[model samples]
Target: MYSLLGVRKKQIAKMLFYENMTMGLIALVLGIAIGSLFSTLSTELLLNLMGIPMDIHFEIPMNAVINTSIVFSVIILYTSLQGFRLIYRFKLIELFRAEKQGEKAPKNSPILAILGLSMVILGYYFAYNFIDYVEKINFLMLALLILISTVGGTYILFHFFTVFLLRHMRNNKNSFYNGMNVISTSQLLYRIKGNATSLATISTLAAVTICSIGISVSLYSNIEDMTKGVYPYSYTHTVIDANKEAQVDATLEKHKSKHQISHDYLLKTLEVKGTAHENTIKINKTELNENTTITVISQSTFKDFAKEFNYNNVKLNKEETVALTSELSIKIKKQFGDLQESNNTKVTMSDGQNLYTYKIKEEFPYPTKNLFSDTFIVSDEQYEHLKTTSKEEITRIINVENESDSKSLTADLKTIIDNKEMPLYDYYTPYQQGIEGSGMMIFVGAFLGLVFLLAMDQSFILNNYPRQTKINLITQSYIKSELQIKK
Candidate 1:
């Protein structure tokens, strides 16, 4: 083989098997082509089958499918290359031959293994990106054929590839059998044994790569929803003080007039019924620390508040009320313990003259973000009546109607709050704070991604590399005729 190439036997074998330069170059190009095909077919096929809607002339699922495919392709390429670097420490030639061929390495299996790994990775890229379209993909049998061929191709490429390369390596010299062909055949047998680990490594890495990337993209996208749309865009400011809504509206109105920011929708709710109470200070109402309980939100105002989030718009009569979410109720129950069950130590704040109280009702899901400190919900009339009867703090919210005018309106509202002497409430500037808050989510995502990438990469290097080397050493035995048979 070397005489024809004018190269030594070892060098020719090494180049053919370890380098597999011709095959590898072709396989890489083929991988790229396959990825493109997956992308194009996934998108265009969907469009052809399901006509686009006239009113909306934008890319829908079609775009997501194609873009996701392309993205995953890039990720797969990157991860495969990384894996290759990790696997090379074992030397590619030995891995394939000792593994799959089950003989000494032709010094060829390493490159052949790389080709195999790359093809399998390409298969995965296609599979992951086209998962939704897999059902629609008519080439299921063809792809299966290709995958099987690729696996067969892996073994054949290492074992007997020299058959095709004989002319290149031997110059059509039939005179030079000299056990060289035998060596190559033996190389093939050994490679069959080691195929599992190499393919498994590639397969495992591909799966991890897909999982991590999906998690990263989905989570980051959700962070945008959480910080941007849900908070600032939906409800700019949340108030704890009930008396401040009117004052905030006045401020917003001033900002609108001054800064051309013209939209502040004001809403307010005060306590009407102090029904639910955690027994504070051993039931001593006269003592200042009588109750460190959550202030009861009135049921009447709760009626109006429910309307904001598209609640049933149900009218609250005398009997029914919103209860705490079951989860929260359980925690509250645990806190009260025996006092909660006995009912003797329990307190209901109701005076016949004004205040009318009832038994405690739980607030399910709290109707608020979990991150906040204190939370309660009730009706406007209930809140107003409570204000008249008790000395508890009120909660207010000045909703901004014009999402576009958020900044100027926030400025206007702040001015109004200052002018009216209403102390600061929880202020949420949709644009300003929303953009800045996104950093934390981004930071967390980056940190987690880095950690995962490092951990998986370490596993590849620490674990796979040695296995690769051992397999190659065994292949070396086959190639160098070091494997002695003692019958």
Candidate 2:
């Protein structure tokens, strides 16, 4: 029984010692992190006080973290190092002992204490540099969060570092209220005293309840995902005639030279020839300018295209027509076959009430591999056949950036455009045709935020102060029974 008690004491002592060291380190880091956060915030506060207009774009919450850390570590080390000086100055027996028997402050207070506080406040002011997201650092919410978290942290810290440590010091009479009770119990009570107060109880509840964060995140994600499919990767004003292709190419070159574009390119148009299973099916082309279909095409560049998406580089059946992605086949009302499907079609027209028959190879979605059109997959031979519809020009695409610095390049290209004097038809710069990428990013961020907020829903709920009733039981019999179990 004594050994078991000894083991418990040792275990508690070890835990207390371990936590003491950890809390010291967290204290150091927290001082730095919170300080940096406040420091940036201080600048903004000062700005507001001075009536200065400030627009915040970027803030890196790293500065206060570093400064506070150094200060905390130094303070800890200084306390330890100076104790060595007292080691020799104190009594002969005190020099040899492992610990002081009483509850004594490790060092002289006032100056060091004030200095530590000052360092902390100053460092914190500097650390919280700038957070437009958290405008008004002195706001009630920030104060409440810090205050409540500090209380909660202090309670847990007391439980781990003070109460646990006091188990070993139970025999120390001067510390344990003349041996009647434990100092750890008193310390624990002191740490959590504020948490029990009427006003602080609300904050305490908010600090512990965690679920409001998840809902906000989910809401944002759903809203974003709903609208993210509108913007395709990139598009340029394209003309299809072979003669107009040169004209459009010349006009594009002028813009390219003006814009200092290094890699201007074009997409190949494949001639796709095939009919639907039913000769009655006349595949009418959707209006290019208005069609909202997401085209998934398999082209001669099928390998390169599929590689880009991390999907299989579909192989054609050497002789059979190439097939579409499963997604596209479903959209186009076609046979749901594998990547290679050989189907037969008869392109027959009623000629003045007489039957006119034309055999057509079966065609699927992979022929027109454009971004916002129907998904089309076509082999090289199939593409050649499909090009008959695109008899005019291949699609010209440009990868370039138009910036303020490249005036000479812009002017040189303008002169070339004047020389060609080609009719300035519809044209779009790369800047005008970028994808709906930011929308997707925003949606994802909102989704994660909603999830986090919902996860913290309880916290938000707890912010609404609850009226809690207190019950005091004064039954001596029941109280004594509980106290006996405690003893």
Candidate 3:
């Protein structure tokens, strides 16, 4: 319209530049204000989730503001240049006809459709067997392969597969001739082609949102069980001497009102060099026979603790053994099936003088008093025989009521007992830490989900806006034609 008014192309370009700059300036200001507000709110929420107590004041960094302004300024300048090029590239008549031009319908091919389906199926296969890939291939390469296949397949499927399917369905004369079927199917085919990339992007975003939120929720829910698996007992520590044990008991009695002891037991262990036949017992693919410290526990104590912890029950005769491994070893074994599944294998341990052999009965994932070594359970008679040759170490395992809420009691006990004499393991610290960590993940996951959802909505709106404008223009044209005919 400005050009048709005898306005010079340069002047028209200048006008467009000014108009765009003004709008850009307004948007930049509003965006900065809104972003600053949200940043403060989100930061406070994250800190709170992590159990951090602090005041959050709304403050925008100068560097962030300057960087944002520079970026948007470049964007506005680029858009202004585009407007200038548009004015010089076409005449006034072409500019007027541009709005009426329709998008060319994309070609639909059966080959492309089949290819897209194949790619999507291949991606799904890789994703399902992700663990296998993690072992066989580089992690980044596997991730890249999945990303390209899934994202590209999605776009291709939306672009060609839907069109092919719809076009094929239209071949049936009965359905094709039905009222509004042709119009609906034809419109969908074209609209999908036009928005295929955006649709694919939205699908990807939705998947990420679901995965993040699902994992966060799962982690938060399982934190308690995970903590118990790691800690096992509410309180555990090595018994340095009888005098220190007496002091611990006295401290517990002093804090009886605050925390009541639920269960207390002593574990006596003897560390010895152990080896399994045919490399039957392994940690990290390394044979346990090579200078590994195997902590020996008696069968009677193992049975008592197993029953208390609701673990697998095992009854062993003389010379029978059960191996106890940590949580990480259990996970590794689950991924790569247990190397030593046979019950016929045997483990031999020496106490620097006498060597005793025991048949392998079962293996269980359990936390032992010895943190960094494998635990071996033997018959009481066998254990006594080995203990005579080696020094016996004792650990006190104490379970208290309201274990998670025993923060004060733990502190008081720590103060009463010198850690140099006996190391104290309290459940409150790890449990509290787990809550904080899980809470932070949940917050982060929820935040990301919201961001993805908003992006999807914006993409949908932007894609639909032009089609809506065309419809409105057609409607207006029809009304004007009707008025002219009535006249």
TM-score of each: 0.36, 0.29, 0.78
In lDDT terms, how accurate is model 3? Answer: 0.77
Query: How much lDDT does candidate 1 score?
Result: 0.46
lDDT of candidate 1 over 344-394, digit per residue (tens): 223344422543333333334433322232334445555555466565543
lDDT of 3 by residue, 230-320 (tens): 6767787887777767878987898788678887877778876677664354323233333665788887888887776677767777767
> lDDT of each model, Cα atoms only?
0.46, 0.41, 0.77
lDDT by residue (tens digit), candidate 2, 1-487: 3223554434444454555557678777675656556666655654443334576433655564566567777776665444434433455555445333434322223443344344434433433432331355655665555444445444344333333444435446666655325533444333332332433344334433322334333433443222222211222334344675565456546656555454344554432332324445554333122222222233556566445434555554544334343233434333222222334443322212232233333443332222333334545554453344433234444334543233344344334332333321112222112212333333444445555556456654563323111111323455577789999
Better TM-score candidate (1, 2): 1
Model 3 residue runs over 4 Å out of place are: 35-41, 51-91, 125-148, 191-194, 241-259, 276-290, 303-313, 325-336, 339-345, 370-373, 401-438, 472-487
Every model's Cα RMSD, please?
17.9, 21.9, 5.0
How well does candidate 1 score on lDDT at residue 30? 74
In terms of lDDT, the poorest run of 10 residues in model 3 is 281-290
Model 1 deviation from native, Cα RMSD in Å: 17.9
Model 2 bad stretches (over 4 Å): 1-233, 240-263, 267-319, 323-369, 374-393, 400-481, 484-487
Worst 10 residues of 2 by lDDT: 423-432
Model 1 bad stretches (over 4 Å): 1-189, 192-199, 223-292, 304-311, 315-320, 324-394, 401-487
